[model samples]
Each structure stands twice: as structure tokens, then as C-alpha cells.
Target: MHLWYAYMTPRTIVPVIFGLLLTVVAVEHIFTMTILHGKSMPFSTMLLSTSGNGSDLHCPSVRLSARVLPQIALASYPGSGNTWVRHLLQQMTGIATGSVYTDEDLRLHGFPGESLSNGSVVAVKTHQLYDETFYDRTILIIRNPYETFLSLFKYIKANHTGAPIIDKYITEWGSFTANEIGHYGQFYTSWMKHLDVLPIFYDALKQNLTQELHRIKVFLGQSGIKGNVRCALANADGNHLRKHSAMPLDFFYSKEKRLAINLLINQTRKMFKDRFRNVSESMGTWML
Candidate 1:
């Protein structure tokens, strides 16, 4: 009798333990799916109810514009604070900004309108130079070439995260600068020639965010801004903003490299000055 009872206990206990383990795994999976994908599930509902705090399940305030909008291009060279600008625009307008390419990170972060470029979103981001037929207007954000290069370098090294680049890549800056400088110049030059383009300098935007945002708002004709401009200003530096230690130009570039960058900068500045002389005069501001 004693031996029979012992065998039965071990067998029953094993099945019970296996069942409990399976239940735990199922609950864990449901919770994970609910949090990441925002799917509603029976277990997830119960879990949230018990926890009494469901802020983690909240989605960003940004939503698709109810009315179809014109396809505006948010054009910029890589690493020119384009993401930051998109954040500000979405936060201010409560409209999701689109991108030609669907960046999963940005999609998960706050850009629910990523990869949507069918005139539904507020604006579509693009690094590539597109023609007039593709977009109604272009918002070109240009940064200092030197700083832009460094930011791009760090951004690539950090794998698109906001983390700082390791010091080891400092040695590679010269070749990187040489390789990318021409492309940067060409990108700006091409966009500058676009018939309907609003060129906004990165420095100017940073210095006067409110003014810049207001200008952008007017350009986009976005009268239904759901978010307060003051609130957007207060939270200007969203999680997407990357903070890097300031390194001198000499630290990243040799004299020759610096000369090449300066020459391009000057040429670009001249082109801008020549192209926008009338507009600058009218606006009373040469934003280079």
C-alpha cells in the first residue's frame, strides 16, 4: 500500500508542476504581447486590473490626421536633427508624421505614422532628393556640415540609438568626412534648388524653437495644432535627442579636411544667398 501511494504522488506532482509552468509561460507571453503590441487579452486585462496602473499601455497622443493632407516632404541630410524636428511637429500638431522608409525604432517610439506617405500624414520624411511631382512642398532642414558629419558618424556607430559613440571611432573620422562631405553638399544644393522649399537652418531652429515651429506651422498650414506650443517647447528635448560630448573640429578633421568642409560650407552659403536673396529680403532674415 505504501509503495503504491509513493509512486502515485510523484506522477501526480510532475503533471501538476508541468501544468503550472505552462500556465506561467502563457501568462508571460500574453503580458508581453499586450505591452508591446497593445493587444487586448483576457490575462492581460486581469493583470492590468490587479496592478491598477496601466500607464505603460498608453499610446502616444499623435494620431492620423482626419482629413487628407498634401504630401509635404521633410527633407534633410542624415543626422540633421530630422527626427527631433519630427518629434516636435508631431507633439505640437498631434498629427503623426510619415516617412518614406519605415524605421521600426521610430515607429515604436512615437512615430505611429511611419512608412505612411500617401498624403494622409502631416509630412513624409525623406533623405533622398525628390522632384516636385512627388511632393507639394519641401521643408529642408540644414545643419552645419561639420556638425552634421560628426552626428551622422556617431549615429551610425551607436546603431541609431541615442547612446554616445565610443572613442575608438575617432580615428575613422577623416576618411568618413572625406567620403560624405561631397554627398552632404550635393544634397543641400539639390534641395535648395527645389521650386517650393522652405529652408530652415538647424542652428536657428535650436536658438529660436518657438519662432521656427511657428514658421513651420504656417508653412504647413496646420491650424489645428492639438498640442500647445508652450508644452512642446517645455519638452523640446524628447527621448530621441542624442547627447554627445562636444569635440573640436580639429579633433575630428585634419587641416585639409577642415579646409574642404569650409570651402563647401562657403560655397553652399553663397548659393543660398544667391538663390534666396529676394525671399530673404522679404522675410528680413537670411537663415544660414
Candidate 2:
């Protein structure tokens, strides 16, 4: 190889070097986008990043707690049963969970006071969609899509200012069911696609408390939990949240509005039907 190079003309070597440089540039462009997309990096970082500098992409990184802390993510779609699970877990294991959003009480509940510098087993509850770098163990809370949208609609109406019932419902379902989270069904699939996530259906939590509790505990690596699952669930049930619920006969105010919202959901499901085909088929059989 040395003798060949030594005997080569400058013209031949120059062209070869130029070709190799172009190949490197092309490879770098594709490689940067592929890995960054896989990591689900932030859009802002992607916008700001240059293909030439792969480091510019933001990758999700789990911060190690200095001590024996095993961080678990309790992530769910908003209006899912994430909070209910939190209450149950706290009651069962007596370990308080933390939220990314400000909930000072949670931070105080057995979490490392020094900003997670110590290894304390703290489950962080989040409404964000799946991103694998967050944690190996995740307890995903899933709710019936219709029920989820209804809860979100009511919550938004009561809390933040928004459009009319049907309009708001349609808008939300069409896009942005979760901010920074993917589409509704995509969010579920993303978590389920990975082996590490344990999905806890909301109905099961309500109807099959014992079984769901067992699954939740097992996923969080807590085995042999005593009979407090039922007790914990019952204790958490309350009148306050129920009081704010939309009236029994006037949730959407009319059948027409319900149809409009349903139509929007159908359109969305049709466009992405391959992944959400079952959800769409179920919606078809749904009663008004």
C-alpha cells in the first residue's frame, strides 16, 4: 500500500482524497439525522443543528443519582390514570412520587433533596410521550380514547380558556393531544413498542384494582405487596374531582357535537389507520 501510494501521481491521490471527503460528508449527514430522530430529540435543537456537527442534536440522557436511586418514569397521556396510580403506589410502598412540573410536596416525599444527586427510588410522573432515554422501567397509564378526549375537553374548559366544546374537542383530537408527546395512538404504540414499558389500562385500574395493582407493583419491582391495593384505591376516591365533571346529560351539550368530534377522530385515524386501525374500528361500533 505504501509503495503504491509512493508511486501514485499527485493528480490521482488528489482526486481519491476529494472523493473520500465527499463520502464522509454524505455519511455524516444521514447518520446525524438517523440517531437524533431515534432519540426523539427536541425540534428546536434539530432546527438549530447543522448536519456537519452531530453534537448539536439534543439526546435524552438519564442522570445518575449519586446514591442507589433507581428512577422510574410514570408517564401517561393527560387524563389517563397516572395520578391515580401515583396515589396507589405511594399508599402501597410508602414512597412518594415526583412530578416534572412543580409539586413541592412530591419532591419532599422521599426523593433526594439535593436535586436527585443521591440514588433514591423516585417515580417521576409525566404527561410527556415515550422517549427511551428517560428510563428503563416505565409504567404507562392508558385510558379509552373517547374517555381521554372527554376528560381533556372538560379539564381544558374548566381550567384554561378555550373554544366551544365541539371545536375544542375537534382541534385537540386532530393534533396536539399531548405537547412534546406524539399523536395519541402513536404515543401508546411508542411505549408499547419497547419491552421495558408496562402499560396499565385505566379501566383495569378501576374495574380490576387488585390485578392492576399487582402489575404496577411488579413493573416497579415491588413483589409481595400486602392486601392494601383495594384499601389504597378506595381511600383515593373522592367527591371533589367528580363534582367538576360535565353534567350527565350535557357533557357535549348535543348529539351533533358528539358526531362532529367523532368525525374528527375518524378522519385522524383514517390518515394514520395502519397503526391505529383497531382504535378506528372500535370507534365505528361505538354508540353515540
Candidate 3:
């Protein structure tokens, strides 16, 4: 009977083969999800980073102490020293830091949203803080209010044309909520006060970088990090800085235009301070 079945059952043999394929696939998935827990088996052969940057996989079974998808936002108004801080952190931490990743990346990859990846820590940088519900920890890097306004005015006037009238752009696009037209400062101020957060002064970041770095390390927990702070600081590579630099100051800054922008910025700051007088007290931290 067994010999006859083997010789006569083509349909049964097809189902058997398909069943085996499905079983193999299921086993692989189980290994990846259940047994591995998003990490590959340690001490087994592993794939190297494609860029020849060495494998993030060092010790088998262990991952970087940083959260799988941690975000490092260098929050600042234009010219408030966001880029400088980014450079310093990249150098000091031996990690790639920048503001380029889009909202899609944050939502899709193991970045601002997903569970942290094994051996990877995702740092995101941006001046525009749109969503308050995101980020495990948010760090706000602030500067003196008057200087912040001056730098912003210089940047916008330099980059955009039709100077004094530029408040239209800020009035229209800068608010956290669409209906809050002519209220760009509200968005900026709201961004200044949201999430599980820390506040870093830009002056401190520039003048006393060591102290700032120490604060950052403490925030991130320096127990598992390697290398000396000087080595990390010396590692600043300019590859990630904004290329095709535009000196906005050369392009626009009619005195009239500067005044208008300054007015709007001041008004925004006032509105922000007025509306959220006790944000820190209310939220237990400063979450907008």
C-alpha cells in the first residue's frame, strides 16, 4: 500500500511539499520574534555594517545602552546655535547627529517611534517641533530672548526676499496650530515647553561644553559608553553640516523689515509667557 501511494499520488505530494515550506518559514519567524527578541543570536556569524563602519554588533547578545530609537533634538531658533551643538555632540559621543531625518523616518523606522534596535541609537535633530506626543525625552536648548530674536531676524532676512513683509510667512506657517495665524511665537514657545524634558542653555553648550556634555552623558547614562571625552570631542567630522551654505544676511535686511520681524518675535514670546505661566508646575515637567 505504501509503494502504491508513492507511485500514484502527485496531488498529495504537492501539498506535502508546500506544507514543509510553510513550516520552515514559521520556524524562522518564531526564531526571530520569540527566541531572538529583535536581536540575533550572540556569538553566531553576523552581518557587518554596509559602509565598512564596523559592526554595531560587538558583544553577542548585548546592545548599546541607548534606547533602540532614541531621538536627540537640537531645538533652537535659526542661528541660536543648533548646528554648533550638533557638531559638539557628534564629536563628543562618537555618534552621528543631524536634523535631516523626516517625520516619515521617525514614524517608520525604529527612530522617534518604534522600539529601539539592537546596537543602534537613533538621534534626531530639528528646530521645528510639531508634535508634542512624541519623544521619550525632549531637550530644549535656549538662548537669551533678545539674542534669539536678533539671530532669527538675521537668518530669515538673509534667506528670504521682501524683508519687512516676511512676517507674513511666520504669521502663516510657523504656528503649532493652523488657526493660530500671526502667532509664530506661540508655536516656538509651545515647542520650548513640551515632553519628558531637559533644558540646556546655548551659552553653556558653547562656552562650557564639557559641563553640557557631562549633563548629556548623565541624561543618557554614561556607564556603558566607551572612549575619552576628548576623543569624542575631537571626532567632529563636518560631513553632516548643512552644505551649500547661504549667508542670509547678505541678501536681505532692510531696517524696516528687521523691525517688523523683531516685533512679531517679541509679541510671540510675550504671548507664550502669558499663556503658559505655570506650564512646568502644571505638567509636572514642561510638556506642551
Best prediction by lDDT: 1
Tens digits of lDDT, candidate 1, 66-167 = 887877899999989899888887766767899999789888877889999976688889999667678878888888887788788878878565544456
TM per candidate comes to: 0.72, 0.51, 0.43
Return the top candidate by TM-score. 1
In model 1, the runs with Cα more than 4 Å from the true position are 1-60, 162-171, 222-228, 278-288
Over 4 Å off, model 2: 1-67, 104-121, 159-182, 222-234, 238-288
Error of 3 at 90 (Å): 1.3
Regions of candidate 3 where Cα sits further than 4 Å from its true position:
1-67, 100-122, 153-185, 222-228, 235-288
lDDT of 2 by residue, 133-229 (tens): 6665677776655566656655556532223455665566444334312356566556655455565667667776777787676665552322234
Q: Positional deviation of 241 in candidate 1, in angstroms?
A: 0.7
lDDT of each: 0.73, 0.52, 0.46
> What's the lDDT of the predicted structure labeled candidate 2?
0.52
Ranking by TM-score: 1, 2, 3
> Cα RMSD for candidate 1?
9.9
Q: lDDT-based ranking, best first? A: 1, 2, 3
- Can you list the residue pairs that collide in candidate 3? 68-116, 68-117, 69-116, 91-232, 158-248, 164-257, 194-287, 194-288, 195-287
Better of 1 and 2 by lDDT: 1
TM-score of 1: 0.72
Candidate 3 weakest lDDT stretch, 10 residues: 279-288
